[model samples]
Target: MTITEYIQQRRMALAEQLLMTTQLEIKEVAIAVGYTSHSRFSSLF
Candidate 1:
């Protein structure tokens, strides 16, 4: 995979882990994964 794709995959994996392992809000998790828009992150999720 390209570097961009790899990075996105890793971000998604980490987002999933944060969602599963923590009580952080969606927006917080999105920010932690480098997303600035919660709606966009929700769509990606």
Candidate 2:
């Protein structure tokens, strides 16, 4: 995979973990995973 693709995968994986293990909201998880736009994160997810 390209570097950008790899990074996005890793970030999404971490976001999944956070969503499963914590009470954080989607927007918070998105931000925590380095996405500034919740809409973009939602689309990616």
Candidate 3:
């Protein structure tokens, strides 16, 4: 895959891990994973 795709995959994976392993809110998790917009993160998640 392209580098951009790889990064996006990694970000999504980390987001999933944060969601599963922590009690952080969705917005917090999104920021933790480098996303500033919760709606965009939700779309990916």
Could you give candidate 2's per-residue lDDT for residues 1-45 as a string of tens digits? Answer: 999999999999999999999999999999999999999999999
Candidate numbers sorted by lDDT from highest down: 2, 1, 3
Which 10 consecutive residues of model 2 have the lowest summed lDDT? Answer: 36-45
Which one wins on TM-score?
2
lDDT of each: 0.96, 0.99, 0.94
TM-score of each: 0.90, 0.98, 0.93
Candidate 3: RMSD to truth: 0.6
Best model number under lDDT: 2
Residues 5-32 of candidate 1: C-alpha lDDT, one tens digit per residue:
8998999999999999999999999999
Candidate 1 ranges beyond 4 A from true positions: none
Give the higher-TM-score candidate: 2 or 3. 2
lDDT of 3 by residue, 5-43 (tens): 899999999999999999999999999999999999999
Candidate 2 C-alpha error for residue 22, in Å: 0.2
* lDDT of predicted model 2: 0.99
Candidate 3 least-lDDT 10 residues? 36-45
